[model samples]
Target: MLVSIELVPRSKEDLLRDITIVENILPQINVLNVPDLLRFDLRSYEAASFAYSEKKDFNVIPHIRAIDIAPDAPLPCVDRPEIKEVLVVAGDPPPTEQHEVYPNTSVDIIKRYQKEAPHLRVYAVFDPYRRSPKEELEELERKKEAGASGFFTQPIFDTNLLQLSMDWLRDETVFWGISPVLGEKSRRYWERVNNIVFPKEYDFSLEGNIHFAQRMLQLVKQQNDNAYLMPLRVDLGAYLTELQSFIVY
Candidate 1:
């Protein structure tokens, strides 16, 4: 199984913590994903990634949103030799009512990005937690046809969701997204920001959330070998000790 960690550092303090977290988890995992979302600073993401790279022999994959990328503009991370893979996402639009660079769906981004840098393996976003599985799978099919190298899923809170849709996952190279929701504070944040509603049966306690994701990881790796842990601005250090103990390979 390929286990990887993802870090999102919005400021210098977070960047320092990201470095410490990576350093603390040294030799535990090599692959780390740094996605560019929210404020959109490619240089900061690169700098943080470079810091992590200096500490560990890690294959740090930085994410670039398609809308932020201009038409026929230079590919920043893709052209760089250190970054072999890039996660291309049709990220959420800016918080304001009006924004520059109108949104392009991930499929649209993939086609244009592949043309721009065919050598860089592009992993498109995959979240099957939608209301319609058929529609989601069909959208994934469109991405598959567009020459996306792999898929990155949203956090899997309900394992039954994946269990019911084995066929949807078996075909692609997936970096399974798993994260610990600390408590109601985190839950409400996800709800307010990302529209992720906590189910009535959802466990909101800190230990419960971590164990939930850990069990989900075991179940997922039974079928797929790749698991990606994304601590979306959450403190990853808290989850590291327990997660490292649970993962066998």
Candidate 2:
């Protein structure tokens, strides 16, 4: 199985520090994905530079939201030889709605990339958390025809997700996302930001939350070979230890 970690954008200095920390654990990870947030956040390209600078062997996938680019114009980052894969989405609008909104959806972006930048691998985002599996497959099939070859999912806490992955997505590249909330503060953050009230079975105390995440991973490792960790702003030290121990060496 391949483990991919999400690297959130931050100040250049902090980002550089994170690169050092990630390098120590890079041998254990297959890919580092850089995320682009709603606000005028640090660009993923800057983070990509740090990954490329390291004289190491690993994959770096930077996200580029459709809201940020024009389809006809040149995409500087897409032209780079080092970045072979990109996750394209119709990014969230700014909280203040201040920025100029680009009128491109991810489908439009995918169609454009398929024709203009045929060399780059475009991945679509999928969220099967609250929805039906059949509907997710229907949508993914459309994306596949449009040019998306792979997908990254929203946080998952159920085994039914694994069932969908194993049954419908067996041939396609899938990265199952898991986030372990450190405590109530972190849990509340998820609730407020994503409005996700964890099902009672998956929500209890912090330990229960970690248990739920572990069970999700154990289920995933059995059926799939790719997983993405998306613990937003939660410290990863203990979580990494748990993952290293759980993974079969």
In terms of TM-score, how similar is model 2 to the real structure?
A: 0.86
CA lDDT of each prediction against the hidden true structure: 0.71, 0.72
Model 1 residue runs over 4 Å out of place are 11-13, 40-45, 96-99, 192-197, 232-234
lDDT of 1 by residue, 1-249 (tens): 787777765664666567677568645677777767666444424753574556557777777767766665776565466777777777667666555664567787788767877887888877765547788888888988887878888777767775665556787788777877777788887777655656678887777877887787788778855888876545567677677766656
Candidate 2, residue 11: the lDDT equals 62
Give the TM-scores of the predictions, in the order they appear: 0.86, 0.86
Candidate 2 lDDT, tens digit per residue, 1-249?
677878776766765566556556544665888887665357886567667666346577888878877655776365677777888866877677566667887788888889878998888987764357678678788888989989998776666756666577788788888877656787677677665657665664556656766777777788755788775545665556556655542
